[model samples]
Target: MQLSENLSPPEGETIDPTSRLLAASERLMAEAARRFPIAGDPHSRAYWMEAMINQAPDYFFFKDRDSRFLLANRAVISDLYKETDLTGRTDFDLFPPELAQQFFEIEQEIMRSGEPMLDMEEKIPDGRGGLKCLLTSKLPMRNEQGEIVGIIGVARDITERKRQEQLHLGQAELLKMIAVGAPLKDVFTALIHLIEGQIADVTGSVLLLDPEENCLRHVAAPNLDPNCFTRIDGIPIGPAVGSCGTAMWRGEPVFVADIETDPLWEGYRDLAVPYGFRSCWSAPIHSYQGQVLGSLGLYGRTPGLPSTTCQKLLGMATHIAGIAIERKQAEDRIQFVAHHDVLTGLPNRSMLDERISSAIEAADDANGTIAVAFIDLDNFKLVNDSLGHHAGDELLKTVSRRMLDKLRPEDSLVRLGGDEFVVLLTGPRRRGEQLSVRLESIRKAIADPVLLEGHSVQVTCSMGVALYPGHGRNATELLANADLAMYRSKEIGRDALQFFTAEMASSAHEKLRYQEELRRAIAREEFVLHYQPQMDLKTGHIFAVEALIRWNHPERGLLMPGDFISFAEDTGLIGQIGDWTLRAACRQNKAWRDAGLPPVVVSVNVSARQFQEPEWVERVASALRKSGLEARYLELELTESVIMADVQQAVALMHRLEALGVHLAIDDFGTGYSSLSALKRFPVDRLKIDRSFVQDLPDDPDDAAIARAIISLAHTLQLKVIAEGVETREQLEFLRGAGCDEIQGYYLSKPVRAEGIETLLRIPNI
Candidate 1:
């Protein structure tokens, strides 16, 4: 087939009959041009030529070397000259001076080179105040003597084709910006310009829905007047609130053909008419889940509905705008979740450090002091332990809001995790009274009673203040010193604030010295484990032994766990100590087996910090494998508070440990506030009654009731119950009567050395 026979329309469009007619006319004209000056009367031949040229759809014309029109077809005469004859007219009379000069230069080039210029695209005025793209072909015309005289040109309008290409390209570029995580504002700006470029006499805008305010906020409107946008911005969406707002409210396209007459614009007509916005078309931008996110709007100077092409462009603009808005919102949500507390919506530790460092730098430049205050809710644990975590979370949120309301705008309040907050303030040095007054207001606000989960709750806080340059330099030191002062506040009274002094610094230095020594203790093998036996209440035989850590301080001599366990936890050194104790206990148990002693499951206490490690489960497996001890002979005891911190995570970790054949037990069970539903999910073998409950048991009615309740609950769940701190004979008798499976305390035997345990195991009965 010939090229013309194989011609197809643009993708997704039908073939235009006008295009086919132009093609056929061009072929006929080409042949007719070769056979010009036929054997006939000159006047008759000229009349036939003029008639055929006039019948052609495309613009056909002849121009002299100086770019003067010699003869023009009807299309050119009507379109360019308003049906006037062009026998002596020049291009300068038909086009703007610059455009005419351009045409003349191109024609002169074709005439000078004796070549043809075909299929060249040009942008020219369409006689109105708009542009039209055209594909033109020009050839150097020759007289009968074979000398060039003028040029003949044929031009076809390609405006629609170019517009479609530009729209597709613009869509691709906008998608690229979204894909590469460009800022939302830049993408919106480019999007508005892209739409305005394709459509004439219109301004574009993008408004994102603010769900909190229930209003449309302008995001991008590069071509719209700023003052006009400011007036219309933040308008609440309604059925008749103009194009963009109504489109968002209805979650569909809204077209107001005339701002003055459309009922949708009745209330907003003044806002539009004064700004020359006579018409508007808006489409709601929807998320992938089909929820409306915002709207993309176009405003025109004339009052009429948009053309078919303009409508298509608007649809594409909304789709692209939707993608960009959704992506940006998702990114913002992720960033917010990472830096803010879920319970109170306060900034978390990560943001706290950044803000503190910035505040410190500002203080240094101004030769001022930065106050770092550490705030700890005094009775938060008591409230949480009694009211459950849900109520606890509610109380925390209320307290956070109250404190925030009482603080200055320049001050920053941050949650450092679990009932602890840090406030950073900067001012001139030696403003202790001023700082104290401010902190007192915050303290009073937090102490106010609040209603949580329908229960009247009240709480107080302890605050510690430390200043820059005097307390210490940098965030770490300042925070540490402030923590020490907060501890002092708690020691002296429940609700109060304490400023860091040289005395506190001296105490911190001592603690720091001990921390350094503890680090060496781990490396030099200066730590030892002691085992306390748990005796079966029915048979009076040793069933298991609990492992306890004691720091063998070089300078201070041997120290019990009470003297150093909390210190280790506070310094974050408990993880390392816990790992060492695990391996050592496992090794000792296997050695006892090798020594022909009875096998007793060794119960090792897992600290909260150690239990929360990402690799904690793997660490347990490693300890068992490396020590040559069977997993069945090892029991990992975790406190109820540790397990209850994150119940789902604790449950999952417990299951994984159980899968490895290790026994699990909840230590100090009755002390932590875990819901029955959460507790039943634990795959534990036993629950240990806390020492506090067991210490005053049998005589103290409340303690006795708690102990009996725990034993019954454990038995109902098909698990064993163990009582620790049973020092009195009466307590042991009462526990045995209450159906306790095991008992461990000084009453059985105090925690003894490894050799001491061998002797006790041999005796079999405690």
Candidate 2:
């Protein structure tokens, strides 16, 4: 019998003595071959075997059947037990009882079954009061006798691999949770739960930093005393504070393995002792750029350090903390942007509407009055035109500041775009006069001068004040009434204040009705023309007729110029009326010619408001062409105000009309703001003396002298002169002696209908 078979060396030894001796010789050759594997023959089998054994990182060894180590490769001898010598050693000598027992069991199973035990894990004592993970594989060795004799084992250190596997699992879980779009609080809670489940001997809390309050608040905590947590809810971050605070202050991880001895717990020993937490570890929750947002910490009731697994779990929790904080901040920023104006940083129009509506409801319930004043600046256009828009923007900003300063704590001053503002004054009005006085005060407050870019700019606003329930019962009506009153204040010369009244509301209604009536009247052809005869001053013979407008109302019989002329002028309807008058006068003159009547020149008056139109000349030319009237026989009568409104445009229009062969006569010549020098610039065929001068003519010396002077001026300018409203023969003879070109009045013939014009023309000479 061989000595190896009878010796029965402890478990894990399976090789016989002869085979063991062969393995020793083979290991020596393997070392020599490993040093010079590529020498002599690069493809030799010994070189290939040496290359495969040395390149492998696992510990490889062969043992005898008596359980003694016979031959061990350098990896097995130097790495497996941190020993350089492994010859004649048994597996029991290299590992502790538990590790040795597991190794032998695996070895015996592999030997008996003649199969390899692949990748079995066992923790071996590291000889430094810790354990290391090792993966071992055992394969049965066969002798030349075809019997299983011993086992050759290969073992690998896999401590880091297990750590990496756990890390990968945590990352996958974290990624899945983040993908589900959980709330930040839920995500933080989930991170804590994941840590508790994955790591052993550790419990922790999550504390978020509140930058605004400059403190840490406990967001989540597990396995901690409720009273202790409440006491640490708002701990400030500083040096030598608790683990979380110290980590945040230092912007790095802090490990206090023994909280009782660490200086960081010097001031908070009671906080640590009562909680039964002897050790603490903290990692800062930081952005990728290293901005510390908060901290994640673990607490251990015993005075022990955190294992590697617990440390890795803390790192993952820190990452999750950063994600949660960023998401919460983004939500806050979005909420702020929703309610505030981007330009002014004030509440926007929607906010203002809600506030106003709420204030109105409160006033109604309390039986109080709320005054809403709408203020609009006067001459703001002049400022914008002269100083440019940049200056205008600065002016608006300055005005807004001033308006805000004038308001009380309870009052709300809102800007309704450029140069317009509204102030809501809540409470009961003392009286109507008191409200008026307060409004005047507000107007004056906004009227102050502002210094802009070294220039003193003055601005004044017209205010319209409307009372709650008195002027309007709702928000919309109150605003409308206030706006109407503001416009009325502007009408009565701006920079004034007015209150809403029943009369103003009635006036607004009347305006609406008038606009509707005017539109319908134009469409229905309800307007007509009357002719007033103009006679020769010296012969008393009617030679021409002046055309005047008359509106025949469906129910009111007849309406004169004073009825709707102002409204027409204000609404730009005068241009249409002027066009109709020109066409009708031209048509009547042409009809007289076609009817074999006298060739009387038909003159129609033009308004100052109508002369400003660019298409005036074209419209007149088209009317003349359409009526088949001779352009020379058609006369346009213009007032002094009409010629003086815009002299350049008027001169150009007169020149254009003269080129078309139409006659131009200045009507009401001396009654307007016109100079003799300005008069000479007009191209005219005749000058008509106004009825105001002729009404007192031949009796009042001033009136007669004025008419005579005008007639003489017309003669000197080579323009025909006509005297209007010549009611008496003495007035007529005086005009005749002055050599007036024409005279027209009741003394000649009143303004009559078209059918009556022939009777007046057929009458005997006066």
Candidate 3:
């Protein structure tokens, strides 16, 4: 029964050590089973025990009460004892002093209690200069009389399982950081560190793609050399660029097993190889939309292809990095949009107050003067109304650029909505003429002619200056005073600058008196509309009439809109007055049609404030309904500035009004700014060329060219173009020859009363 020598493979056959050991274990178990009936057979028992101990794959051992090793498996011998015998030698002879002491204490406890310890986890040297985790079990070994004689132990390596668990926990922690919106740099550094921990002898890095520069820049390099990292920070991405740069360029994995031999690393080899890096593997980080956002790199000191598991870890890391980077970039874009103007990409009102406040603080520390200049482009509306919104936008951009060129590097310039901007200049006190000279240069720069929409256009700005600590304190006061000064410049003559003074404040008070009068005048029904007949260019007959509002003042007599309209707008009374004008114009048109006069569309000018009202479209509908005028007889004219301010909103509103059968026309078409793409989306029926373009028509080449362009653009869009302020036959003839559809000016008839319009309508060929 104890006839086995040693288990071995069959003759003329070959097998791996693991397979050979497994076969030997099976044979030994079978022999032990057959010999188990021989009671007290010492030879058989010794042979069976020795065979099993030497052939088993796991570490199996036995020790006496003193914890000396009586037996050990081949696995234990190979890992710990090597060529030396393990029998009768305690764990102290095989392991370090601390490990041996721990084993002896555990064995003594098992022996004393006659019990077993199961699945106890412990770390031990793997004999390869690394640690290995084991799940060990120890039990008391008893004799025939049930008296404990020794302790038996068995252990299985669980290093891989432990590694997986730690990797999962680390990944979860990183995802949590990303979910909570941790800074990108912090997340990237932590991610790189995690990757490096999971892979051996490798440094991890993250390189973000800078699209503007077409380069890969190091965002995170947890263990790479600082000097080398800096040198490769902005490496240009190309097909043959180093691992990270090439990976991003190709949008795929790139593996360079040897830095010195791989052609992809030709130029970058010096940056890495000299620093102990011999190999690099990179995986591209891509956005959900498949755009290459960045790349994750694992750089190794040894040259070899990554194992399958290592490559899997790299893939997962890149995915997580992409999510973090994309989220951060989206947040940055939102922040930028919130603070910048969508039109010109300039800091808007949201940032203006903060910038000015900061400038004020800096000035206070230096006992300096700060000039807040309010700039209004004079006749900018005319440009918009003449050239169309597209031209207007180009002119504004040109003006903005010219103005920026004249400002100091420390100065702040902000666009405060249509045709208005605020400039902040800071310097020592009594830099008086210095600030003025800058403003003059800005003025001259603006006055320089620039081509827009094929026409050479020149624009001038009116500037109002208010000094901090002099024109009152704070952003609001300074801006208000500067605005008052700007208006003074407009009043004296446009293209000029004026400093805020006590007299300007007095004028503002007088305007308040006029505001109240204008408010009451609305309630008293003292406002009237004058009809300016628009003549059809082909038929030479009045087709549509523009309704111009007139205020009948109790003391000042009849006043033009320019006299008080701006003040009304400032006081927020324009909405009520505009509503009255709309209703009156609708009623007069309906009354004329009922009186058997020729039916014509009555166009009413809508102020920017009125057009911006949430219920403006409904208001227009109500006017037509209450006045009993067919919607076709009414047209609402909105300025280009108003319509272009919020194109999406304006488009939706215009469509709704058009559904009600009311036509829309862009009033002062050339003066405001709009892109051609956006213009085509508008639901408009006409383009009214601003009078400023027609005032010098047929003579001023720029004006004539602008007028022709507007006419052509309108007709191409299947819309009508009307020339306003045509005071002479020569202007009318030019407009007619240029394919203009209609003309409205003194040449036809100055804006007249409803009776005058009726009389004109009754005349033949009016």
Compared with the true structure, what per-residue lDDT tens digits does model 1 show for residues 572-591? Answer: 99999999999999999999
Could you tell which candidate, 2 or 3, scores higher by lDDT?
3
Clashing pairs in 2: 9-66, 13-67, 14-64, 14-65, 14-150, 15-64, 15-65
Candidate 1 residue spans exceeding 4 A from truth: 1-88, 127-129, 142-147, 152-154, 177-186, 361-368, 378-386, 428-441, 444-449, 458-462, 488-497, 503-766
* Backbone clashes (count) for model 3: 15
Which structure among the candidates has the greatest TM-score?
A: 3
**Please, what are the lDDT tens digits per residue for candidate 2 over residues 1-766?**
2434444556887878787776555555556666765555444555656556756887778876665677677676555567777778776887777767776777777777888888888777655555668897778889999798988878888877876786678666665454433566667776776776566557778887778776788877766777887888788889988898899889899999899998999998888777678999999999766788889888888887778868877887798678657644533333333333323444544345566788888897887788889889999987889887667777777777776776677778776656777778876554554666666777777678877667789989888988888998777778878998899989999988888898888876788888788777777878999999988766667778899888887878789878987778867788788788889889888988898877778888888766777888888889999999989888889987778778898999999989999889999776555554456678998888888778867876756766766776566567899989889989888888878888889987789988888777667575
Angstrom error of the Cα, residue 120, model 1: value is: 2.8
lDDT of 3 by residue, 404-480 (tens): 88877888889877899998887653434667787788788989999988899988889999998899689878998
Q: What total of clashing residue pairs does each candidate reach?
A: 0, 7, 15
What TM-score fits each model?
0.57, 0.40, 0.58
Order of the predicted models by lDDT, top scorer first: 1, 3, 2
- C-alpha lDDT (0 to 100) for residue 385 of candidate 1: 91
Q: Please report the TM-score between candidate 1 and the true structure.
A: 0.57
Give lDDT for model 1.
Answer: 0.85
